[model samples]
Every structure is written in C-alpha cells, then in structure tokens.
Target: MADIRRRKFVAVLGGMTVAWPLVTRAQQPVKKIGFLSVSSPGAHAPFVAAFNEGLKEVGFLEGQNLAVEYAWAEGNFDRLATLAAGLIHNRVDVIAAMSGDVSIRAAIKASSTIPVVFISGSDPVQTGLVASLARPAMSPASA
Candidate 1:
C-alpha cells in the first residue's frame, strides 16, 4: 500500500511539473505589433504575407498569441505621421516601418518609447535612424 501511494504521488507531481510551463505560457498576454508602411495594400500584400509566415514559424499566430495592427500611408507622404500616431495610440508593443526612410521617421517621431524597426534601402546611420551600426541609440534594435 505504501509503495502504491508513493508511486501515485510521484506520478502526480511529475505531471504537474510538466504541465506548469504550458499553463503559465497560456496565461501570458498576447503581443501586439504595429506594421507601418508607405505603400498601398496591393503593393504591400506580399510583404505582409511573408511577415505573417515568419511569425507563424516562431509560433505566433494572428488572433491567437499575437495581434497586428496595420497602418498604411497609401503612398501619401503627408499621411505617414498621422498613421504612425494612430499606431502609437493603439498601444502597439513594436512598430515595423517598411518601404523607406519616411515611414521609419514617422514612427520614430510618433513615440519615443515604443520600439521601431525599419526596412530602408539607404544607410540607416546616414538617414539619422540610428547613432551607429553597432549600438543603435534609438528605442530598440533595428534590423
């Protein structure tokens, strides 16, 4: 009887240990990301699909563990600032500014705290995005 009780207790403890991490992970809040682009929806479709695929590869799925808010300037340079501000107002955890330096500049100007990632063809340092290539002086690391 003692051996059977010990075995059961050990099994229960092991099961709980195995399940604890999963429980904690499930309880975690969903991450929110802001995708800011200067191009129209039709032009940005492929990039958006690729971004979603990358996120899925890392175990993040839209409407599940992650939520993405897309803000497009629709090729209007004047609207970039407003769109970036809207993303900040939505309380996005991170901003992905795509297309060019204008989108990145808008996102940076919108918020000083929120991290901004940019995809620019020009040199980031020369574009005033970061202080240096090694240690970026901005919100967070840009890639």
Candidate 2:
C-alpha cells in the first residue's frame, strides 16, 4: 500500500510538471523588453530599482505581466557593442539604454528596426543614434 501510494503521487507530480509548461505558454505575453545599462551595478543600483518600481506601479512586474532582459556594461564602453548584439539576438520588443552615448550608439548599430529608448547625457542626434528624438529611427552605421 505504501509503494502504491508513492507511485501514484509520483505519477501525479510528473503529470503536473509536464502540463506546467503548456499552461504557462498559454498565458505568456507576446511583448518583451530588454534593458541595457553601461554603468556598473554599483553605479546604476538606484536607477535600476526606480525603473523596476515604475513598472510595478504601472501594473507590470518583472517576469509576470511583462518580460525583461537586462544587460549591464558595467562602465565598460566596449561591452556595449556585445550587449547590444545580444539584445538584438534575443529579439526584444524594445531596448532601454542607460549608458552614455556609446551604448546608445551600439544599440542603434545593433538593429535599425528594434526601437531603443536611451537615457544618455550626450546628444543622440549628434551621435546619429536617432534621426531625431521625435522620430527615433536608427540606422546601421551611426559611429
């Protein structure tokens, strides 16, 4: 009887685990957001927290109402290119960049189609990351 009970419990657990993916897939949202920051974790802590909190306030929570992919360059300007390429490969709906002009430029170079939201100290237009902020369209070569 003990063996039989254990077998049934195991069977049920297996079934539930198998079904979980289908159930989750059925409810998953289509939109995905990728956030890239050039600053290190130590530098962007408050900004990251505030960004998450803002989303939470707007009825969106990380991994719940929406999906987010975060990449931090950690103040290394060179990593921005690699990070931007990674985000592009992930095919995120949009990218939010928190670095300086370098990151913004990288994001623009990574993909022209993927919309990028940049919070940078430098001028995005002058850097050619965007044709204009009002109509922010990125081209391939913006260096």
Candidate 3:
C-alpha cells in the first residue's frame, strides 16, 4: 500500500508538471485529472488522501488549479473498462490508474491520447505494459 501511495504521488506530480505549461499558455479552465481505481471510494480514501497531499505539496490544489474525476470499480474488475471509458469520454488530460493490472490495462485500452500512470503489483514489463522498467515505451497514453 505504501508503494502504491508513493507511485500515485509521483504520477500526479509528473502529470501536473506536463500540463502546467500548456495550462498557463491557454489560460483555460481548471485542468481535469481522471483517477481510476478498482476499490470502492470508502476503502480507498487513505490512498486518495495521500495522493492529494502530495499534489498540495507541489502547489497544486484540487478545485483550484485542478479538478479530479474519480471512478471506482468496487472490487469488480469487469467494471474497470466501463469506468475507464467514462474518463475517456470526459476527455480528462491525465489518468491515474491504481489498484492492479486490470485497472491499468483498462485505462490503456480506453485512451491513447490521454496520459496514463498505472500502479500494479505484477511486473508491468512482463505483462507487456511497457518495454522495460528502466526504459518504458513512449506511447501517447503512457506517462
């Protein structure tokens, strides 16, 4: 869980940095980030809180500089694809997929343009999510 939390923190920070320049240039509305998880919101509150705190530390406040759209599967792996589709339909700038490989793969399938940061217990490279742990593939959907 700690590893998951740390990955979430780093992913959000990277996403925000990538979006910052474009956001300032366009002067658009609050940037939107999509959070896709396999667990219920109630059960995943601590993980979400930790991620939010990390964002705050880097000067990005939710509802101020950014807005997050959360989708939970309630432990149902089948629902991940649907939830990921919804985030893509909403046109979120980035997606943080946490929980496991199922959620991550669902997000990967959902959008190629949106950046996806995934957390998984299994080996992502072996699963073909990336080329390797050290040098990941540069896909449009990959963060």
Instruction: Please tell me which predicted candidate would have the highest lDDT against the true structure.
Output: 1
RMSD of 2: 6.4
What is candidate 1's lDDT per residue for 49-124, written digit by digit as tens? 9999999999999997999999988889999899999999999999999998888888888888898887779888
RMSD (Å) of each candidate, 1 decimal? 4.5, 6.4, 16.9
True-structure RMSD for candidate 3: 16.9
Most accurate candidate by TM-score: 1
Q: Write the per-residue lDDT of candidate 3 for residues 18-118, one digit (tens) a residue.
A: 99998885574777889999999998999999999988998778988789999999999989999999999998989999987778888888876787887
Task: After superposing candidate 2 on the true structure, give the runs of residues whose Cα lies further than 4 Å from its correct spot.
Answer: 1-30, 139-143
Against the true structure, what is each candidate's TM-score?
0.78, 0.71, 0.73
Clash tally for model 2: 0
lDDT of 2 by residue, 38-126 (tens): 88778888988998898889877777767888889877788898998999999899988776777777777787788888775767677
The runs of at least 3 residues in candidate 1 whose Cα sits more than 4 Å from the true structure, single-residue gaps closed, are: 1-26, 139-143
Ten consecutive residues with minimal summed lDDT in candidate 1? 134-143
Clashing pairs in 1: none
The TM-score obtained by model 2 is: 0.71
- Candidate 3, TM-score vs. the true structure? 0.73
